[model samples]
Target chain A: MSVLDSRRGGGNGNNDDLASLEAGLDALETHLDTRASRWRKLLSATWPPVLAIVGLLGVWELIYRSGVKPTYALPSPADVGLVLRDQLSDGTLLEAMGTSLTRGGLGFLAALAIGTPLGLLIARVRPIRRGIGPLVSGLQSLPSIAWVPAAIIFFGIGDAAIYAVVLLGATPSIANGMVSGIDQIPPLYQRVGKVLGARGLSAARHVLLPAALPGYVGGLRQGWAFSWRSLMAAELIVHSPELGQGLGQLLDFGRSNNDMSLVFAGILGILVVGIAVELCVFAPLERRVLRRRGLLVARS
Target chain B: MTVLEEQRVTRSTGAVSLRGLTKRFGDGPNVLEDVSLDVAEGEFVCLLGASGCGKSTLLNLVAGLDRPSAGSVHVPGGRAALMFQEPALLPWLTATQNVELALRLRGVGKSERRVRSNELLELVRLSGAGGKRVHELSGGMRQRVAMARALAQDSHVLLMDEPFAALDAITRDVLHEELVRIRESQQLTVLFVTHNVREAVRLGDRVVLLSSRPGRVAKEYPVGIAHPRRIESPEVARLSVEITDDLRTEIRRHGAH
Candidate 1:
């Protein structure tokens, strides 16, 4: 056919060049700023959040300097900064941060371990879904603080109690996140999977799980928040010397001693760590998933 | 309610035979009733109907995605590969990986999978775009990749349910040409379903129109026009107009008591 076309001198030789050129043009138009001067995009995306944070700190400093409240009641930004500096220098704050982060990390890991399989079972098993679907949703609305007393009763007021509270708080959100994620997947994906002979476990692995990722990511973020909050709440309520000083313990100690700056420092510590985890761990994961799927619109 | 039984047939067998195929969903009226058709090896058959017609249900029955209430759907060359209107590529997978996923399910091995996946991508004219994610592809490209994924199943029969119905006219024309070229080169038996008259006449060797409300074969036109047929050509237009008239009458009858 190629020889005949070439002999006739009319068919595909010129059309091939034209087709390639058309493909090139299509590629150019559909290109979505990948691997081409990406750093510029990164910098542009980063600046606004940085500036807003700096502005927030500036306003806090100005209000303190205006002498709006008693110095004891409202510590100056400098005083909090000094407290931060002192804690770093003495290594006590570092130790507390280490302790609290360890607890939060362990608790979140435990929740992930337990919650993922539970969520899968809840999502896939019809009888269990019918029985416990509402129960899981109900558990999500119950504040993690409410679990503190029950945890204290079940596990006698130590690290075990804290761990128990964190698990109770985080597991439901993770499980429910996955449930909703599986629910939201378009039926088209599963049909495609089946036609391609992906059934049962293969269908769940290839189609359902990956399709449900965006919602699962949302659940993970919520799960982390609940775990962190529950851990802190448990720490504040049960202050045994054997458990070491977490930020929550420091805040509790500050309340007892009337050290407002210390309390302020602890609150700041909590906020910073939460933001760091979100930025460092989960935000990048969510962004990658969304960007790969073109669900995330690139920031201008 | 016959299970899809494996029949020992010689290789190079190229026909799908449906004998008294009927389907009904739970106590509702029959979705497809007593539909019988035979498409030869390397034949292009288009199943045309209105929206509510059970054209899709018939395709699903042949593809083994749906069970018929009665009768038989025998694709002599084995299970027909199916393509939907949507690309339905897994977003986590790149275009090549989407095709590769199909191959992998067929138990193709690692090194061979990569080589075969690249070959399939090239067949769809998406050789360079294999690295791109599904979302990054244009609508036309995604559908082409879907065609590639469907083809990757390596089945003798291909069942497509309005695969190109979603594309704009220009892109649709280009893909129509691509599909015909591939069908000829591969000698595949195709059972394509569409509501579009021009599309049916343009691609099919035999255009089979199904009536709505328990879809059954209403009419059949054997297209004698030579290949490398253009969708905009006069031959396609003349046939499309005649078929469209019949289709309109069929649809209007559905509204009557």
Candidate 2:
């Protein structure tokens, strides 16, 4: 086709100048840093979750006022609020939260220390990956509640029993995270790493780990859930005077005393803490990693 | 022996020597049958043929991405870096980091890597693209980044496997000029692989045609054309037609029982 008729983008300019202009335009327009505008973007992104929480509270208030059951069976939202207020005023709520947080935190840290390397080993070495891969999945599927009885027998109903349960619950998730992360890494990236002389330890450190990070982070989130659940289970099932009373103990105590409002408060506290940690910690950490690599998209 | 050690011994300037280079795949038919060719130091050589002619297989052997089944292949550099048809830059890294990665692997010091990566990027005329991610770049820009990445290896020999095959004609033309400029400036020994006879004629100082399946070198033509030879030029067209005729005969031979 003649130059005049061959117009892709119009205006019959000099070919060299036009080519350079087109190249510059292509470079500028398709560039990676198309981040949203600051304040408005953040506000828009946060509105949905904020609204959901408010709507949930409204529903709870509505259910409370309906008076569908006896107070012993289903306490009103106001009754639960009163218990929460009393616990907060007395400092018991803080103490229980601290106790549970310490146990879960310690267990998770230990799981991370043990499980990350174990998972890397399992992911990298073919024999170990095959041998223990299925077993790890099996462990993940087994509930932390089921471990409480065996753990008590093994460690005799003390801190050891609690820790044993936590270990059983959290380790699988951390290891599975590493395995899945490693598995999810594209073959091309590995090949590129190899081409770049990234062999053995260097490859794992620079390419494999970073490439597999998203999956590993996913694993950590799941592992935290397991750690939290297992610690609560242990606290409920294996009671000891030496061990400080935690959220789980408070929950059990509330149930025994037939204080349904206090029981609802404990349940709400656990859920609120879980959701809070996920939203405030893991979600931000994950978004930063994904955003740096230009993989993150605003959640609708 | 490693391709690097072989390169050093033959490093009388810029020359690639492959002797009795036979290759096979796991008890199967030989892919390359006792093939041998010598590419002069500072010469742009294109291995021209149709698919399964073992053109890429030869390039891989020379690149040290693979080893030949038998015989010796020597590039001037102990290590010869490669550019694939696809711009295989790491998606996670920006253009500069992709190039710097090669320098990093080569044990280039942390202080020197940035300087060297920038220099190489500038050499490819992508000076200001240090911070650009691979996915953000256009097709031609991506190839230039790939070129920069390959050059970062600082090897004497550069093996390219159809590096411009995926590009549009205009971009490919621009890159052809860029390649010639880079080769002239750097005094690089390029072992380029392509099925496009016109591209072969346009780019190479010499074109080596390979016969199909169990590929062997069928003919070698020294283009004798000056640099910046257009694809439409009479010499380029004449040589391209000659190479195409040879390539067709090889394909016809494959069909003749």
Candidate 3:
């Protein structure tokens, strides 16, 4: 309102009344939301998942006590918890997680490096898209575990083989995510860029890339899922003394030793890691991008 | 043809000149057919037509966003800046950043871009809203930011395709005045496209009516109305009625055939 009054003074006095009227209209029309405190918002969001977990544990305890299976096979929740504590005290669980996460992180970075340019090429170059678009999508559906045997033959049972499977698993999803992201950009943006004299590389950098970011982030999330799954599959299959233990290898060890509690602990570790990464990294990133664009409505 | 030949054609034309410009998509009929018009230096011309009359298409051709299938568009003023019905600001950038982008693309240095963008924002009376995101601004304010971005292009010819059509009546009136004030101070040659007859009459030096379905230039009316003209003024109302009658007749012709 003050800005409006200030603008009124300098302009032709004939339109001063009109300027003040406009300021009034603008102020009256805009609706401001009163947001809740941050702590309250966090508590509201966290309660549902916490309740669900507790309910699931209750069900699990009931099943264990039903005596439907032998004690060795149907270990109680407390027994599995004890196994987890034992592994934690010995530092083996931490080591296993560290190794698996390092591999997953490095493998995902590689997939991202390869996928971005490939996706851009497919999205933009008509001939390239026509030639390889189907092939890339086909790769996504073909399961990276199916490549383990070929990867083993090519690179042996080592880090290279594991990384190969991870890349093959995640790269297509990432690339496809990128392609879909670019496809969804409204044609209006491109026209605006052209009018602003942003041609070729400049258009891609400033206009196309930022506009396609939400979709690209979606792809990265899917790609991470694929990488994690592929790494676990490879780790379970390709165990060697030279290669350190991972969550998948730990599960394989438990099965061989017939320790049901250890096997459950390994499964829990894998699930926790996956969910934590999603909640901490991808969900927040996607929410930020969408919220800034006014695509996400703020829940009261 | 060659750049030399292109430069020669532009030199002989007005700020913006169209010579028999024809546009078509694939095998479909021409969207615009043999349409010709001109806007002298610092002139404001409103192209008035009904829906599907190719008003937007003509602006696209003039803005060089689309090319004509035949004939030429000569803009001696270099590339024309276009404003759409929607503000079309990038949602992620703040208002100043959006204006700065146009300057950056024009090869302005970093330090100069900042200063110039602030000046442009002030010109549109959006100085305080420079750091606000696109979504945070009201619809009318967003359009003002859009105007700032367009002005940052420094193009002599400004092509507007119903830029005020989406606004509320009061806001639109305020903007109409803002546009006129800006046009005068900047000495901009404006080609505004709108279907509202009164709006064309209220703002333009001349109103060009285009016939629908192949979009030919049907007629032209030069407004002798004085400046500071109100949208509800008697002269504007009389001209709007005449233009509306002609527009209805033009639309009826399509049904007869």
Q: List clashing residue pairs in candidate 3.
A: none
User: What TM-scores do the predictions have?
Assistant: 0.92, 0.89, 0.94
Measured with C-alpha atoms, the lDDT of residue A29 in candidate 2 is 45
- lDDT for A251 in candidate 2 is 91
lDDT of 3 by residue, B186-234 (tens): 7678999999999999999889999988998999998877677789999
Between prediction 1 and prediction 3, the one with superior lDDT is 3
Indicate which candidate wins on TM-score: 3
Give the Cα error of residue B193 in candidate 3, in Å.
Answer: 0.6
- Per-residue alpha-carbon lDDT of candidate 1 for residues A1-300, written as tens digits (9 for 90 to 100): 321122112257644754675486457547666553768877977999999988988998888889998888888778888988987899977788888999999999999999888898899899999999899889989888888888888888799989998999999999998999999999988999999999888888888899999999999999999999998898899788787899899899999999998888888888888889999999999999898888998554
| Candidate 1 segments exceeding 4 Å error | A1-25, A32-68, B1-14
**Residue runs of model 2 more than 4 Å from their true location after superposition:** A1-29, A298-300, B1-14
lDDT of 2 by residue, A1-300 (tens): 211132212223533454475466456546455556888898997999899978988887777678787668877667778889999899988788888888988999999999999999898889998898889889999998999999888779799889889989999999999999999998878766776678888888778998999899999999999999999888987786788988899899998999898888888778877888898988888887787676876564
Clashes of 2: 3
TM-score pick, better of 1 and 3: 3
Q: lDDT tens string, model 3, A1-300? A: 221232222355666666677677667766675789989999999999899989999998999888898989989889999999999899988889889999999999999999999999999999999999999999999978899999999999899999999999999999999999999999989888898999999999889999999899999999999999999999999899999999999999999999999999899889988998999999999999998887888765
Clash pairs for candidate 1: B14-B41
**TM-score comparison, 1 vs 2, better candidate:** 1
Off by over 4 Å in 3: A1-11, B1-13
Better of 1 and 2 by lDDT: 1
